[model samples]
Target: MESPKRTRNGADVTNAAMLVDHHCHLDFPQFAEDLDGIIGRAKAAGVGTMVTISTRIRQFDRIRVIAETYKDVYCSVGTHPHNADEELDIPVEDIIRLAQHPKCVAIGEAGLDYYYQHSSAQGQAEGFRRHIRAARETGLPLEIHARDADEDTATILADEHAQGAFPAVLHCFTGGRDLAMRAVDLGLYVSFSGVVSFKKSEALRALAAELPLDRILVETDAPYLAPVPYRGKTNEPAYVVHTAAAVAEARGITLTELAAATTENFFRLYTKAQPPEELDPSLLKGAPPQ
Candidate 1:
């Protein structure tokens, strides 16, 4: 059996301590250099593990290379709805086969994005259906990204859930409370990103506070949406610290308490991420080094 990791405050992972970045695109070109330093800083921030989400199934090999390169890193396997047209033929079998790799932890970063409409709404929806099916077939968590299409997203998820049960997560979740409650009802996890830290995101913060601890997760979604203080600068995995702090305050808890809770939530949802290498006592004591 795997040993549990100790958080920086000196708590075990099972007791609502330790933080995990459930969604991030670390494979983006923005981190081509100094990725090592990014990982190091993220670890120091109490973000012991991260998922470098895959936006294109065709490029999943490269993403897998990322997971293979680091102990704490893992990846997903699917195409973004924005790029649905590009990898339209990504077979479910191909995705399932590729996901067999131990490093591939989830099935997406995929879903609808009406806000951009980079791909036709139809193509996006079609791609979303395919990824959801993949999630059901592989028993891997679905990393859903919805923007300006809550109704459509919910409709699809509801339809798919009836087919069979599967683990799914709403990544970078900024939806209204209704969606949060619906996802929770559907046995899904909601992961907030740096956007949760924005001054204009009081509604989202309120939703975070309202959410049950077991269903809440936090992510950086890095190379974008860097939390405040680090806002306006290039976002990196390391900045997840600020995101966690914002989430902690939103939920009326200390950073260590928030970190521990979110971390436990991620592993509970993913069930594949191994524990962090060494337990940090400072994090458990809520006095992690600044």
Candidate 2:
């Protein structure tokens, strides 16, 4: 955990063994009053950097503020599949345009979500396509959020990548082995979250172990998906160490090695990230109403 400290704007860390949460959502109200404390714990826990991903393009300006204010945090642009209908008119050009912001480093937390189907399938698919185009046009990595729609997710990704390749990471992966290979085949990275730390996730841990080291990333997907010790409780970025520990165990490496490798993977993909400012107390939005 003790490494060279760096900002989010692509500064080299003195400690190559530092860990990074390639994806997190500190903007959610769940962390409200404690956002500063949450981030403090994360930094103290050795999480050197984090990407505070976005779910609604309309809320992106606020997302930018979080990234700009925090020295170790960056943000993304795009609508989540659940919010697809709310932002149906958001075009690929708009996404690409907004992504030009210095702190907007990735294209999405967008993809199919058949499990919930919160938005119509067509809307989700359309949004996914728009984000794919944005990712390609901006040359920013895509952060995908597929869940229980493996076939459609696989199909769309294959179709779009056929036209032109784009960097992408399958965030919070929870599908079968076939989908994993398909994602890998298209040269997209796979990010493991707390789900990989679950008791029945031996299958997922096996997948994590088998994947090429270069193509893997670790994430908290925080405010949700807390790993083993904290499962079913509210999660924040600091607990990324537990999930990182799970990933390291799956890969048969020490937490130190996992920290080093994933930190490298994060910077490689989030190339636009440099050192950020000091951590922002207002990173999350309003606290959720109880």
Judging by lDDT against the true structure, name the best candidate: 2
lDDT of each: 0.80, 0.81
List TM-score per model, in order. Answer: 0.89, 0.88
lDDT of 1 by residue, 1-290 (tens): 11223322343333344567778887888888877877777776556788999998888888899899999999999998889888877777888898899988899878999998999999898899888888888888999999898999989888888988778989899877887889899999888888888889999989988888778888878888887766787787766766777777878787777877776666666766666767554433322232
Q: How does model 1 fare in lDDT?
A: 0.80
Tell me the spans in candidate 1 whose CA falls farther than 4 Å from its real position: 1-17, 280-290
**Can you write out model 2's per-residue Cα lDDT over 1-290, one digit (the tens) per residue?**
23213322233333335667878888899877777787777787677688899999999987788888887888999999999989988778889999999878899889999998999999999999999999998889999999999999999999999999998999988888888889999998898988888999999999999998778888889989987777898877776777777777788876666766666666667778753343222321221211
